[model samples]
Target: MTEPDPPPAGVAQALYDRRDGRLALEVVDAPAAELARPHRTNYFTAYWVRAGRGTFHADGTRHPFAAPCLLFLTPYQAARLDPDDHLHVTAVRFHANFLCVETHHHEVGCNGVLFNDPYGPPAVTLDESTEREVADLVARMRAELDTAGLAQAELLLSYLKILLVRATRLKRGQQGTAGGGVRLPPPLPELRELVERHYRRLHAPADYADLLHATPKALGRLVKQHLGKTLTELIRERVLNHAKWELLHTLKPVKEVAREVGFDDELYFSRLFRKATGMSPTGFRAFETDVRGGSNLSMPSARPSIPPPPPTGQNADRPASDPPEPGA
Candidate 1:
């Protein structure tokens, strides 16, 4: 099956398109360490704190947001903010049609990739000056709604666009310094599909590049630019996670499990396992039973991280440049 196209560029129409006629933003007081179950919502959210500090765990990394900071989570990104004490928060949430104007549309537009990944870090942070600027804008936005006019919704939409543009601009500025506009190669859809189907086996960079008719460097760069990982790193992690899984379940012995997971010699398998994880196969199993109930496993259905490594020379564990934080 093909992946669905991301939503098009329009706020009000998109809101009407996603959830008809209900646009709202609120300032609520809440405690620290708030947890959220994995879920999807139909509104954009901007959470800015005047003071306080906490770490936001999204995707797989932790973004530590201190005072005078802002975090944008696209409508579909999954996250839970562990707010700090005395959290002075401003949140702006609205439906799609609200951002129908062409200018606002570009901020959210990008093949929907910006909105899709939650585990990535935030795009940018507001310094003291920008914080005051945005905070005042949000305050005015919060106010004008009470004194409704024919253009009340229109005015609110304008503020929303301003805020999004400012934030996106800040992100673009930061990205410009590090690097910017490193486009992913074509054939991503086919490449992704191939990864999805055969991640458990295909690890060699060339195997993937060969299948997709791209160069290994190009594929590596694509993964880094889009997914925040090199092709080899992705493949290795996937294989490692699966090795952990089969190690804890089924009747496969250490050597067989190694072979089953793309490792041939049991001794070499032990070395790779130690490299990926800080434990030996037998030691991991022992720890699992001793620690978490029986299996050192997530579930039979736990998917591999990516695809298995190409069975040779694929370890540059941490990519020098991972993808920028989601919603960037």
Candidate 2:
């Protein structure tokens, strides 16, 4: 027989947050010996195990399933569900647009995609005490579902946040199946770390070279060689990225934006933003506010001048993109 259709999107749900978005709670009881290819759910989902057992094939490996084990499947992963016995599955699905509106929110890729680690799928198995917390959150969700009113969306968000945090803390998995995980490179991944830590400072090239204990010329040469851009380029990209985020998301003033990104002078920040983005912060925000408001956040008109590769962990905040290690 042909496989049945996957569950409908947003079934058993309603509009909330001024009808800005919706969420679904579903209970599935099934008995199927074998299954077809792994299923892909475009919307974000968190599946909690209430009863029965099954094995999940995800992130290129099989994760054994038992009752009370929670799985956090991120957007765009393929997973196969096969029940060893019958299956009782409780799931929550929410649209991304409600979380943050994107023009074409349903579009294939999630920008600002955080945590691309699949072998890094969050698996948290709840112990008895923690399971009660999970149960309480679910109960609240069930109660929220019963009432129909204006504030339900905000209340739902509150409960969902509680459940997600609790599940991540209690059940998010600590181990990946052997050999299914990606290897963090042998050398320390440093440049990205530097960017991550000091990007907020918006330090200049010379500052970084000093921190890395190398001459500015050597650092520039090494960075361009590995990362294909000069040190000046990396700092600007991060500063600009943060600038864009604040412009589009927060109503923070121009001066505050400069301060947050380490530009003492609002005028300098405006100049730098224009150089990188081809527009001032106000113009950038106006553009995004026009399209996505929460809809269309603008991208750098030019590609990152120096898109440094992940740094070697050895030199905590330096880029492997920089010159070879002295010992090496």
Candidate 3:
């Protein structure tokens, strides 16, 4: 079956179109009506809520939020903010190519901790001081955004890195053992990083076990003990997540999407997708478009628009010129 044309560019593009597809920042006292309904974006988002209260939805999970909080949304993660009218929010949205977390994971660990985390609340509750610090960083970013300096993009990237680092620290603190007691297993962080880096190519728990230098049995035990799921389950979740994103965002054929996610056999991939999501990939793609608006199917673009890679000259695993933290 032929796929339809992609949906219209979202509000972020409306805000950043003149910037030539790089980054956009805005302080929103009022969000559009569509934001209250579930929607996904093609860029990463960070929302700092300054006041009021509401429930923030991510991937069908509802997280309650109060004032002075930080919320994150990765690309293609379905999210909605049912926020009160008085809510004040500072929103930062950028394409993956603009500041690729996959490229700079070693420098700032926000990709796993803040954005693509499958285990934690997408919203981080902030203490007063941390909130103030992040607000200052956002303000600095806003300042750089307003001026057309030679290093404007670099300056904004620096501020963004610092903000991500600060949020990572806070998120780690929040996930620390309750009652200030038990130490988490040391392998957990590396495990998450490995999964994020290699999930596209490695779908088996044993593959991750070999990379970690641990026996498959031992690694599986650790994952189940800490994360409450078997290691295989975790790996599969990551693969399915990427597959779903491709289905929603790209016009790739089902076979191509399957292969992109490491499934060489399209039929097997379709079976797995059906088992996990209760629909075939084609059905899911059509359903996503239909719900977003009325069905007006059109021919796919000649060149399918896949998500952007890490910026040129940067290694996928690590960048050579990882920007320094703000005030560092």
Candidate 4:
């Protein structure tokens, strides 16, 4: 596979703010044009494409998007825009310290639906009416960011919450229609919740089956049919996602990260990580740091011009060694 182009030389590292270290929010009316190239950011990003037609490449998948849609990207996800026509885009970026999606998931329900659902598209197509609603929210957010006042962050966050909630509803409605209005089985939804809660300790499909009061065979079949992935693959992907986040955003050692993710053997963890991400833990951290031109905590004055390493084998999003599900 071809490697992605590095950020242009002398490009400043993207940060929430250099003045107030505590503030972790930024609203860009027109972000850097180089975003059309493959690049990853250290913060959560939402691209409000007011007018555009393009293919959004994220984590090795190409999603075709059009005007008046919202594209969501999690931190450290590889992304690029290939516009078929001139694109007018506004970017909103925020660090996890500013607003933790998991903490606010109960209110907005965007933790999985908008930001981190591995099985779903990363872009939300908006109808004309919903587009107007989102555009109003973005305008208000921009206005709030420009002004300095008390509870500004709170107000901005409230607006963000509303935007997320609306997008989540739209995305769910679209998904329901696409799936012919077939709702997931009870066990499938429960399985997602169980995996999110217990993935660290419980690594097997049978473990989740026991918790959901279903046979592993049945649950695995359902997952494969609906989600196009095996149960083991789902668990491993979640584990690797956490591992990648820790690797990118924190200075934790690989051994510590491995143990935190329920692997007692650091070497085994490294092997699995390499199999899934095309880089060992240390290498992934070092390479991503170099690509971003600084550690997550520090800002770089200029980005270095260095090409990224190509994939070792298969796409990192799909591990080659994912075991087949029971009775597959």
Top model number, lDDT? 4
Worst ten in a row by lDDT for model 2? 10-19
Residue-level lDDT for 312 in candidate 4? 60
Query: In lDDT terms, how accurate is model 4?
Result: 0.72
The C-alpha TM-scores of every prediction are 0.45, 0.43, 0.57, 0.61
Per-residue accuracy of model 4 over 1-328 as CA lDDT, tens digit each: 1122333343323433323444567777654367676666656788888887887876555567788889898765667788888888888788765676754668889887888776566678877899899889888988888886789988999998888889889888766322344766666767877888998889998999989888999988977666656788779878888888787667788899999989999999998876554456776676555544452433242543344444463454544445434663
Where does candidate 3 clash, by residue pair? none
Candidate 1 — which residues are off by over 4 angstroms?
1-21, 24-40, 59-61, 83-86, 100-104, 107-120, 176-328
User: To one decimal, what is the Cα RMSD in angstroms of model 1 from the true structure?
Assistant: 20.3
Please give, for residues 1-328, the per-residue lDDT of candidate 1 as tens digits.
1112232232111221222234444433333433323322334566776677765644333456677766665543345566555566655665333442222445554212223322133645677788888977787787877667778876776676677667766765544221234543466656767765676678787999999888889877766665555677656655665676576555477888888777678899797765444456776555433332332233242334234444323334534345434653
Between 2 and 3, whose TM-score is larger? 3
Lowest lDDT sum, 10 consecutive residues, model 3, at 10-19
**lDDT of model number 3:** 0.69
| Deviating ranges (above 4 Å) for candidate 4 | 1-23, 31-33, 176-236, 244-328
Candidate 3 regions off by >4 Å? 1-5, 8-34, 176-237, 241-328
Question: Could you tell me how far off, in angstroms, the CA of residue 145 lies in candidate 1 after the best superposition?
Answer: 2.3
Best by TM-score: 4
lDDT of each: 0.55, 0.54, 0.69, 0.72
Q: Backbone clashes in each candidate structure, one number apiece?
A: 19, 21, 0, 0
Tens-place lDDT per residue, model 2, 1-328, is: 1121223242221221212333433222222332324555433566677676766754334556677756555433455665677655666655443344133324322222211222132345666887788778777777777785778877876676666555544422433222223433311146556767887784777777777677889777755543334667656655665676678667788899899988889998897766444456676565435333243334332333235577666775775557876896
